[model samples]
Target: MSLLADVDFRRYWLARMVSLTGSLVTYVALPVLIYSVTGSSLWTAFVVVAEGVPYLCFGLFAGALADRLDRRRVMVIADLVNAVVLGSIPAAWAFGVLTAPHVLVVAFLTQILFVFFDAANFGALPALVGRARIAAANSAVHGGGTVLEIIVPGLAGVLITLTAPAPLLLVDAVSFAVSALLVRAIATPLQTGVPGPPGGMLRDIREGVVFLSRHSIVRTQTVIGCLQSMTGGAFMGQFVPWLDQTLGIRPTNDARLGIMYGVWGAGGIVAAVLFPRLSRRLGEPRVTLWFLPLSALAGLACGLATNWVVAAAMLGLWAIVYSMVVLTAITLRQRVTPDRLQSRVNTAGRMISFGVGWPVGALLGGLVSEATDPRTAIIWTAAMTGIGVVFAWLSPLRRLAGEPIPDADETPTPAQREPVPAPDRIEA
Candidate 1:
């Protein structure tokens, strides 16, 4: 049965799509606003840091709590909070009080809320669609976002000329408001279980950690996800500066910058359309092994290209393989993880992959860009792709010639179940 026919999944998908459409536009505008004001790659990198730091601090807690509470309520409340906070951006801009520091603060707070929302969201998908349909559902959810990325950013690029990026955030604020409504409208319960008596948040966190650590496939891919995000962070941090410095595309009003980023959306489309086909033929693990090496090469080419058109083209190819690697790895983890552990395991993995990896890469890229040049920094960061390839080859993922993926819905009886690993106590 098609997941589209499922009411809960459809509403969930719509809520997500609406939020992504707005966010993608803001994604382009935020950097443009930061760079136009601060004129420093390091400051731009700070935005990436702000986006990640909250996840580092609250990611575990959010995940633990989400498992215990109503997924729908947590998600809806988070969206409402985000809507209000994001609305403040345009308010500040209207009052002529906007500053880079204000932007950073908002960015930090926004992500903090998202970490909570994200914890619930990570669990919601598998609960709604089941593990068997994950690949197709993911493709649809992300592909719809990609299609918007292609259209909205290019339009946003042109829109930048007509207004300040700060005001554009109002659109994001509205999108969040709409998403909350849609999520609230879903009738089907998004959780399989409410879980029995409280284990306490710390213990709950430990349970998630224990499950992820004991599972070989999940652990290996968590590291791979980090490497991939690092590669992403570095390239993203340097890109604005690279475009501005090399191609004379100013952040204030350059359609070229928007058009360039939109091209990545086109690449994402290629990935979305191609992933299921490739996974069916090549199998999941092998897909990453082969495609990522080419992405590394493409990323390197992005740094070396002299012309804007060539650089954009290289970035598009890089985006395709990069997105594919991420989708494959994420599905593998979700497929292995049981429904109860979904939020905790996924959040921990993302905290490491996105929170830690992205910030570190961006910070390093910023430092490198400050010391040398954006192009040099880009080349250095792009090396993370190659490094990830090495990690994948060394991990157990490489030798699985025909091992079947885990069944997420499978629950062994107590007598049949192997003794699972216990929680490793986290020391303060």
Candidate 2:
């Protein structure tokens, strides 16, 4: 069946698009709200910290909980929690009691909820779509989001100009509520029958860690993913400064900067459109091996481009290659993991790659730019992605370059196995 024809997947796709569009608004609006309230860049910076810290703190635990409980319920509860927490912002504003501290706390709490929401969501898609269609499904979903991303920020910026930022969050709060209802409507059996770890949450987490360690493809890709995130973080961290130094562009030139980034997003949309077909022709392993290195080269070109047109073209290329690498890695991870371990393992990988890698790379990039030239920093940061090529060669993923994906109907062995009756089949 075509993915869009699946009722459950349609609901899931709609939920993601709605939530992401709303999130685009909140992403711009929240900082605006914080800045308006405090007039302090320091407090505005704290919101970024608040948003990140929760992912680091709660990511693994959230993954374990998602695996242990009913994933659907976990997602629903998380959405509702986010709705209430975010809804409180407008409520406080209405009461004339809103403060920077309140917004920061809300930001932190909502991110913690997102950890749970995402951990559940990472696993939920594979269950809904089946392994064979994972690539196409992910592509379609990301493609839709990429298109909206291009438009949503501009719209959000206009909305913020005309209305208060606090009320903008109400839109996000309502999106979460709608997402919850849509998720609750899915009839798929999201929970795996693999027996729970006997010890505790830590044990469950350890099991995920061990699986990630032993699984050659996941380990290689996870490390590569971290490096990719670091490179991306560094490039983006230094982007504005590099543009100013290299092209005489300033933040005031919002149109030019927006176009550059929009071009990058356009590349991502193209990658999403092509991913499934590319996976079919080259196979997942070759796609990974080739795309990682290609993205590094593309990043270098982007850093060195002197003309706006050339820079946009290079940035677009980098985005396309980099996004393809990411999509391939995620599809591979989802395909190989067992149902029970999916959330725990995937979320653990994300915590390592995203939570830790991005901030570190961004900080390092900023330091390099401050110590030297922004162009040098951009080139150095972009070049660091080449390390992924070396890592991929040494790991098991190299074996997959020409390999077909494993049978979709098969289940991988969990780290620990108990002798038990077979579980009932759950339709995708």
Candidate 3:
């Protein structure tokens, strides 16, 4: 079916686009603000760390909660909380009360809330539409976000030039508020076909872990994703520093970084447009295996680039291939997993891959960048990314020809099982 035929998907896509634009605004503004405040690159890195750490810590728990709760409500609460927290920064700045400490604190809080929002989002999607449409839905979602990533940064760069970071942050806050409202408007019911046992949070967490362990496809995908994230984290963290220090581009002064991000987004947009068609032709797993290795090589080439033009070209290719791999993976997971388990499985998958890998990779990248040249770090990261290709190659997933696409009768599992209310004994 055409993506346009799905009104709910359209609403979700539009909401995500608005939210992503705000996210991009913050993405550009935060580093600039932190740098302006401290004039220390190290401090800026620390802020980045602060933003990611909480997500890593809370991701699994958040996933379990998403499965247990009303996903739309979870999304609404998450967006509202973020809107308030994000708004506080600008308010503080306007009152001359925004301090470095305030920034760090807010960054941490924002990440914490974001972890929950992200989990709910992943968990919620399969329920909103169905497993059959996941690929197309994901394309729209990723495509919209990619388009924003391309446009918003340019807008953000212009905005930064015209005003201070605080105002941009204020705009971001409003976007979150709007996103919350949009989420609230989604009228679809979310009911998991398989319910978890009544248990405490720790018990629920354990169940999620056990579920993942038994699910081979989910397990394999998670491992591959983790490794990819590790490499990506290392590349992003170290590549700029290397370019600045080794290639003689001023990382701090140049618009090269912005160009890199924009090009990457452009690549993602291309991939998102092509993914559904590509999956149809090559099958998802084969497409993933083919593209991932090539993307890794592109990453390696990106590390080797000595000039902005070459680097931008390589990064753009990397982004395109990376987007294809990610889109393929998401489609595979959504298609194979039962609906009731989708949120938990999605959370479990991300927790193992992204939640664990990002901070460790970033930390390692920083150390490697500090001890050697950024190029060296990038090369090492590229090698790691390439190594992940082995995981894809060896797994049963590689042999997976696209199964017949799911249809309406094939009810995938839900994100959570309906709770059995207290049993009432017959008063006879």
Question: Candidate 2, after superposition: displacement of residue 288 in Å?
Answer: 1.2
Top model number, TM-score: 1
Looking at candidate 2, the ten consecutive residues that score lowest on lDDT are 419-428
- Per-model TM-score, in order, reads 0.94, 0.84, 0.87
- lDDT per prediction? 0.84, 0.78, 0.74
RMSD (Å) of each candidate, 1 decimal: 3.3, 5.2, 6.1
lDDT score of residue 137 within candidate 1: 88
Candidate number achieving the greatest lDDT relative to the actual structure: 1
Ranking by lDDT: 1, 2, 3
Instruction: Please write out the lDDT profile of model 1 over residues 1-428, one tens digit for every residue.
Output: 37778888889989999999888878888888898889889999888888887888888888888888888999999999999998998999999999999999999999999999999988888888877788898898878889998999888888889988899999999999999999999987778997436668888898888777766677778888888888788878877898888767777666787789889999998999999888878888888788879878999899988898888889899889889988887877777777787889889999889988888888999999999988888888888778888988887677663555546656422322335534542110
Model 3: how far residue 374 lies from native, Å: 3.1
Mind sharing the TM-score for model 2? Answer: 0.84
Mark the regions of model 1 whose C-alpha exceeds 4 Å error after superposition: 195-199, 411-428
